[model samples]
Target: TELQSAQRKAAWADVARRIAHEIKNPLTPIQLSAERLKRKYLKQIDTDPETFATCTDTIVRQVEDIRRMVNEFSDFARMPNPVLAREDLRGLVSAALVLQRTAFPTIIFTAELPEDPVIVQCDGGQIGRALTNLLKNAVEAIEARKGNDLPPGRITTHIVRTEQHTTAHITDNGKGLPVENRDRLTEPYMTTRVKGTGLGLAIVKKIMEDHGGALVLEDAAGEGARASLVFAQGNGRAGA
Candidate 1:
């Protein structure tokens, strides 16, 4: 079954590569045409100016959405192998946290990193990206929880090191994990949310695998989800 799944994913990735290559060529021209049309004729339209503006705006918006999807397809189809090296894992986590905190100022962010650096043999950029994506997902999940009675959104992060593994946990207080098909979230094109290319977790999983590690998804203590990036420690593979 795993073999079948892997084959299916390979086939889909080939299709994605072709689709991205073909679709991206026209998106820029289409967007530019729509913008030009709007800029040149917004006020000259005699019949209904508002309707003309709305139509052009819709065209531009939809084209941008398609461009985003195409980029995701490209990213998924051509994920590069991790460039592993020795680096401070805590610094990577802190960088990711700083980015997410700046992006989502309303969400309270907290970190529990140790005073000393936790060094590991891994791709610092890829690890930072994985952390950033998880943090972004957590923020989006909190934003999606629509209610007047809900408390302020919060995200917690921690980097822990043991004899066997060095792990980073990103926990959020938002919508909890889905009861069904939780494990499938890491599969390519699988998603719980309506928006997104559904490749965030999949890419993260690939990055971890490249480093001989794992990406673990689970529920938080009370609410929301926790994504753990675990790198092997003292195995002549990952940690120092």
Candidate 2:
């Protein structure tokens, strides 16, 4: 157990260091060049000022977006080891749903929490982050659906505890997983969206793995996506 943990930590640290180095290298130059062009061309341009401004603004905005994504890479690479404790799984799911509701008001959000607590040994913070990422992905998937007659987006969270494992399922009424390479969705840098960095699902998968669990993504019934985070029922104490 100790050796596996150490290996995992080392792998992540190396990934973080490499990503930070690679991405941060060109960002500064890109930012500075955009600023320089804006300053030098703003007054000297004989053409429309608005066009120049828009171009410069676009470059600046994209740069910032990439910078934000780099930060996410750093966060994932340097993710802390989860501090395991007995925590209420229902409460955790509730907190995630509440935040997502506020963040995406148009989307209908629902939860199916048991009357009794579904307790689990987990790192609440890490699990919470994983939940948030999954919820965010669901929202994005709904937004990406193309058509005028599509139904209103809906997301549901449910928890199921069995004798050997506890599972939290997040289902969304959105465009489901792609038919090709669906299993690779959790791999790093794999994304369906034009603007997505593709690290969110990868991070969630790593978190689940670190907790001695797994992340499963599937196409919901006829449409939409379903993501399940499965945790082993260590000692069978969860939900007791």
Candidate 3:
């Protein structure tokens, strides 16, 4: 089963790499052409200037969106190997939480980090990226639940250390876990959000795997979903 899973992921990665390469080249030219058309024809269109402007604007906007998706595909296909080193997990978590808090002021973000430093072998940048991605997902989930007679949006970050591992849990009061296929959410191109690129969790999972860790997705105790980043204690180079 594990071998099958690995084969599927490899196939997906190859597909992503090819798709990204093919789609990225035309995007810039298309966007530039749309802009040029708008600049040249927007003033001369006397019959329905609004429609012409809107169409050109939509083309430019959609091209940018496609470019973003292609970039995500490239990132997923070419994820860098982790440069693991001893670092303070609490500091990493705090920095990422602060970023999310500043970005989403309305959401109440709480951190329950331990007083003493919890050090782990990881690439700090990759870990921070993972935390930020999860926090952004939480924010999106909370936003989706708005106007549903829900309570104030809240996100909680807590860290726990065991004898063999260190786990950081991000819990949010938003839409709960999906009713089905929860286990496959980390696979490429699988997402519940309509606008999502679906590569965020896949990239995060790859990062965790590179660090000899795992990404765990589950439902929170009461509402919304919780994502945990579990790092194996004293891990060295990946696959070592």
TM-score of each: 0.83, 0.78, 0.77
Which has the better lDDT: candidate 1, or candidate 2?
2
Encode model 1's per-residue lDDT on 1-240: one tens digit a residue: 999998887888888898898998998899899899999999799999999899999999999988877876687687767777788888898889888888889899999999987888888888888898789889988998977989999999998888889999999998877788887888888887776788888989998999889999898988898989998886334333
Write out the backbone clash pairs for model 1. Answer: none
What is the alpha-carbon lDDT of model 3 when measured against the actual structure?
Answer: 0.89
TM-score winner between 1 and 2, please give it: 1
- TM-score for model 2? 0.78
Q: Where does candidate 3 stray beyond 4 Å?
A: 1-46, 236-240
Highest TM-score model number: 1
Clash number by candidate, in order: 0, 0, 0
C-alpha RMSD of candidate 2 = 4.3
Candidate 2 regions exceeding 4 Å error are 1-49, 56-60, 234-240
Query: lDDT per model, in order?
Result: 0.86, 0.88, 0.89
At residue 216, candidate 3 shows an lDDT of 97
Residue-by-residue lDDT tens digits, candidate 3, 114-232: 99888888899989989988998999999988565679999999999887888999999998878888888999989988889888999999999988799999999988999999998
Residue range with the least summed lDDT across 10 consecutive positions in model 1: 231-240
Residue 140 of candidate 2: its Cα lDDT? 92
lDDT at position 165, candidate 2: 83
Across residues 1-240, which tens digit of lDDT does each residue of candidate 2 receive? 999999988897987879787987898899889889999989988879889989988988898888878876886787778888888889889899989999899999999888998878888998998999999999999998999988999999999888888999999999888888787988889988887888999999999998889999988887899999999886227453
Give candidate 1's error at residue 232 in angstroms.
Answer: 0.8
